[model samples]
Target: MNPFTYARAENAHDAFALGSQPGAKYLGGGTNLVDLMRETIERPVTLVDVTGLSCEIEERAGGGLLVGAAVRNTALASHLAVRTRYPMLARAVSSGASAQIRNMATVAGNTLQRTRCAYFYDDEGSRCNKRNPGQGCDAVDGFNRYHAILGASPGCVATHPSDMCVALAALDAVVHLQNARGERTLPFIDLHRLPEDRPEIETLLEPGELITAIELPPLAFGARSTYRKVRDRSSYAFALVSVAVALELDGDTVKDVRMALGGVAHKPWRAWKAEEALRGKPATAESFRAAAEAELAHAQPLRGNAFKVELAKRTLTAVLAELKEVKV
Candidate 1:
């Protein structure tokens, strides 16, 4: 970590003032940023602490939930309303990191956590366009089994590593942000950017913009929702292939679906094509399999990660199969 100035914000206004700088990065729980800084990957000369901001839950007029940016991962994931109404989100959060880390990680920082791509942090390699643009990408030819398959350009192939993010994408949550320009709300799907050569720019937020809150509109899909993660380990490891699904069924057919995949794209990969294929179709094992097949028709996997296409499809199929039973 570099010698830096520290400002503990007493309120949102104070936080915004310190945060609205050209190169400022907000410090939430510091679970991810702190680690990256120690490795010298992030060299922010100023750190603005936003932990003092109000961290309470706000209920919207429509029974929706607006979670504070300072809300800890544990609190957001285990809230009575969240656990009972957004079980997919609860499960995703509960499955990540250890209890200790989860207790300190904030929901906002988790959503914007830097990718765990090995190439991005290995200062020695420096081939990650995300870490250093225009140097060239080593992951394009190196060990890329965990790299992206969708929305990837020749410049980068790192996958978004947050399990909670995939769930949020499926749920269509809105992210609230603030900067010198005032406040704005962006859809969860549009918040993050794919590599597209300009891999250094990972999100739509302007520099020094502070994430204020995350709001999830009320949905009745909770009963049929599920989050499934397959990883190298059963406990506390990143997803190898994960699916977050919330499906609405009409008798033996699909009415609506929310499908998002992690570990397969630079951003949360929404399987809209697969959802399109399944809606109004018979909700059966065979139908689920066929939908999975259609989802990967456009997938362009790299040499080491080609198997991810089949694996992701199978994982999603199993999730849908489980959801069908839950819907019943």
Candidate 2:
């Protein structure tokens, strides 16, 4: 790791001031950033610790929830409001990493975590566009079984690796951000940028912007939501394909729905097409399968990851079916 100066921010004002320095990065749980620093993928001269900022989970006025960016993953997942009102978010958080890592990982850190493409990490042996822009992406033609199938370009085929983000996308969560300029809010789905020619740039965040909190809008049927992940292993494994869905049904007809897909895209892919197709339609296996097809219609899979198309379809169908049977 490179030699760096460390400073702990007592509040957001301190964080913004300290983080505005050259080559400075905001430190949350240091779960992903620290590892990237060790790999020399990220070399910051200053580390501004923001874990002491806002860690509260407050209920929104109407029915939503306001989650502090510094809130730990375990705390967010286990919170009564999250588990009961937004079960998918809880399940997604629980499905990530392990208990120890979850205990240390923060909400903002998890949301901003980088992709886990093997080629992107093998700095010495592989050429990754994400690691060094225009150097070339080895994962495109190399071991791409776990790479992206959606919103990927010729320069990159990496998938975002945050399970929590998948649920956040489905829930239409908004991210609260602050920087030297001022404060702003961005829709969670719009936070991450699609990897185009400039694969190095990930999120749409302005330079030195710190995530303040995450705001989840109200969903009356949020209690019926669920998250499902399929991976190579049962634990401590990233999703091969994951689904997060919140559905509302009127008898056998779909009244409303929100869904997002992970492990198949550059970012959490909000299944707008699938949701559009499912809404006002009969809630059945056929409808669910058709909706999945509609969502994956534009998916362009790589050589080794083509199976993801079918896997995603099947998984979406299964999750929708499972949620349909829920009494709530």
Candidate 3:
């Protein structure tokens, strides 16, 4: 790790001021940042510790929930309200990393995690566009079995590696941010940018901008939601393809649907086209297949990840079928 100055931020104002400095980074749980530092992938000159700030979960007006950015992943997953209402979110968080890491990883840290692409992590290599812009992406031609199949550009083919983010996207969450300029809110869908021309610029956050909390809007079918992940291993493995489905059904017809996919794009892939096709439609296998196919029709798969297209469809179908069977 590089020699760096450390400062503890007293509040959001202090944290943003320190973070806006050149070569400074805000530290929450230090889960992902610490690993990148050791690998020499990230070498900040200063670290502004923000974990001490009041990071508590609060109930918002109108039956929503405001989750502090510094809340631990384990605590957020096991919270009584979260487990009882947004079970898909709880399941998604629990499905990721080991128990110890979850206990130490913060909610905001998980939202801002780097991709698990091997090329991006190879600091010694000179072919990762995400790590070195305009250097060219080695994963495009190299072993890219886990690379993205949707919303990818020639500059980068990597995918975001957060299971929690997929659920948040489906729940229509809003991200609250604070910076030296002031405060602002962004929809969770807009938080992550596509790896289009600038793969290095991952999130919409400007320099020194700190995520204060995330607000999940009142949901109708959260209890009927489900998350299904497909990976090489059953435990402690990154997703090959994952689906989060939060559906509200009216008898046999779909009343409303929120869906998002992981491991298939540069950000949490919201299946808005799929949702449009399913809303007011019968909740049957044929309807599910058509909706899934509609969203996947835009996928541009590389040589190694063509199988993801079919896998994603089946995962969507399975999740919707199970969610439909649950008594509302």
Candidate 4:
């Protein structure tokens, strides 16, 4: 870790002011940032503590919820409202990290967490474009079973490792952010950038911008939603392929659907094409398979990770099949 100055921010203005300084970084739960610091992957000189600021969940006007950035992952997962209304989110949140870590991890920190790419963390040898732009990527030809299959560029093949973010993308959640200038909102899907030419730029956030809260619009259909993660081991392991499905059924037909995939792309992979294929179609195993296949058709999996394409397809099918049982 680097020698750093620490300041506890009192408000958004204070946080923005403190964060705008050179080599400054906002401190949330310190679950991700702290680890990166110790690894020497991140070396911020100034740490502005924002954990004590705006740490409450607020109910929106239309049955929606505004989750504060500082809200702990455990609190969000176990909150009565989240469990009842956005069960997929609750499930996703609980799927990540451990009880102790979740108790300390914040919602904003989870979204901003870096990729768990091995090369990105190998400070000694590997060349990671995410860690050093124009350095060239080593994961492209390395042991990359966990590398990305979709939205991967030649510059990088890393995947976003946030289970909560996958659910947020499916729910059409909006990210609220603030800076010294003012405030702005972005769709959750747009918040993360693809590992394109500029793999170093992970998100769309401005330098001093801080996430305020995430607003989840009311989704009555989310009552039937669920999140499923498949990994090497059950607990404390990152998803190899995960699916979040929220379906609205009209008898035996699909009325509406929102599907997002994780551990397969630079960002939460929203299966918009698959959702389009399933809507108004008979909610059957064949339809699910076909929908999943339609989305995977565009996936450009690397040599070592081509199996992820089929795994993602099967996972998506199973999630939709499970959702089919939920009474509309």
Candidate 5:
């Protein structure tokens, strides 16, 4: 690891000031950033600790929730309102990493976590465009069983690794950000960028900007939501394919739905096409299967990860079928 100066900021003002310095990075829980630093993938001259900032989970005035960026993953997953009102988010958080890591991982850190592509992490042996722009991406033609099938470009085939993000995407969560200039909000789905030619750039965040909170809009069907993850292992494993969905049915007819996919794209893929196809359609296995096909119609699978297309389709159909049977 590189020699670095560390400073703890107790408030947002202090965080912003310190974070604006040259080669400075805001530290939330240091779950992902610290590892990247150790691997020499991220080298910052200074670390501005922001874990002391807002950690509250406040209910919005009308409805919804405002989750502080510093809120720990365990806390967020266990919050009464989250577990009861937004079960998908809770389940997704619980499905990530392990209990120890979850205890230390913050909401913002998880939101900003980088991809876990093996090629991207092998700093010395592999050529990763995401690690160094225009250098080339080994994962594209390498062992790509876990690579992206959607929104992947010639420069990079990496998949975003956050399960929490999939649920956030489905919930239509908004990210609250602040920098030296001012504050702004971005839709959660728009936060991450697909790896195009410039695979190095990940999120759309402005330089030195800090994530303050994530706001989840009110969805009456949120309580009916669930998250399902399929991985090579039972625990401490990233999803090979994951689905987060919120379903609302009116007597076997789809009234409303929201769905997002993980481990198959550069970012959490909001299944807008599938949702569009399902509305007003009968809540049957055939309709669910057709919706899944519509969503994956444009998916361009890689050599090793082509099975993901069928896996995604089957998982989407099964999840919807399971939700359809639930008494709502």
Candidate 6:
């Protein structure tokens, strides 16, 4: 919203070149970045529009999908291949922002979105180290119900807010980035960074890195996956405790499952421990309840977020039970 120079990039090379500038930033869909600019949370003197760099969905050799970073959420979700093979991801994309937003929000842009920390948006020099290094964090002890419970430190308590991230983690998607180092593929789980000592750096992307595409492996269970989100309202709200699960059950026994959580951690909290507990186990309510308990054993709830422990467990149990009833 401020005075920022804008240029439409022609290709990946051009995009990265512009983004590598000292005070320049890449513009994908302008969904999150524009909003942050409006609040002065992000103040870039130059904006390089990368949406013109033709990036779309393509089929990979492994029967998987290669989603270009500039591809809009609506296009990705509505694609026949994505709808048939990755319904959970489709549903997650649909659940985001709104129809108008989804039409403009790109896949990679949404994945790289910053936290919804209110303190970060305060332009009046509030106590937020993420906004200003060494400024201190005030949300650590104030209105932190939506803050993180995992991968949190005294320095910061912000939570990652992306439903598609949970689904991507559950499905083991890989992000392909083009930067000064050429091209590299990183695991989706490894993309986000914890607010350990530096809350300002939220991701592993270096300066000038352009997210090219996200590649999902040929997962047998993606079609049967489901994402369960619990918020204060039924629609248009962030999750209180959400679960994205892809389950394959054999009658009363579990075959395989992939689980991830949102609204609880610095990144998509992949529940590998919970998956281990449920695999090959009896697909019963008791077994699911036990798995839920086992998964939440290490959660360190804060002053106002103890309810998340119960909410997460119940949600996991419900998802497992529901999967069992309609086993793939």
TM-scores, each model vs. reference: 0.97, 0.99, 0.99, 0.99, 0.99, 0.96
The full ranking of all candidates by lDDT, starting with the best, is: 2, 5, 4, 3, 1, 6
List per-prediction Cα lDDT, in the order shown: 0.88, 0.95, 0.93, 0.93, 0.94, 0.86
Which regions of candidate 2 deviate over 4 angstroms? none
- lDDT of candidate 1 over 164-204, digit per residue (tens): 99999989999988777788899999999998979989899
Better of 1 and 2 by lDDT: 2
Model 2 Cα lDDT, one tens digit per residue, 134-236: 8998888899999999999999999999999999999999999997778899999999999888889999998888999999998999999999999999999
**Winner of 5 and 6 under lDDT:** 5
Predicted structure 3: clash tally:
0
The list of candidate 5 runs beyond 4 A from truth reads: none
The better candidate by TM-score, 4 or 6, is 4
lDDT of 6 by residue, 1-328 (tens): 6798998898888888888988898898998999999997888999999897656788998789899889998998899988888887888888777789889988988998888877777769569988888889988877788887777888888888888888999999999998897889999999998889999998998887888899989988677888888888877777788898888876768899999989998888999889999999998898888888888888887887889999999999998778666634
* Candidate 4 runs further than 4 Å off: none
Model 1, runs deviating above 4 Å:
none
TM-score of 4: 0.99
Q: Which prediction has the highest lDDT against the true structure?
A: 2
Query: Candidate 2: global Cα-lDDT?
Result: 0.95
Which residue pairs clash within candidate 1?
Answer: none
Which pairs of residues have clashing backbones in candidate 4?
none
Q: Is candidate 1 or candidate 5 better by TM-score?
A: 5
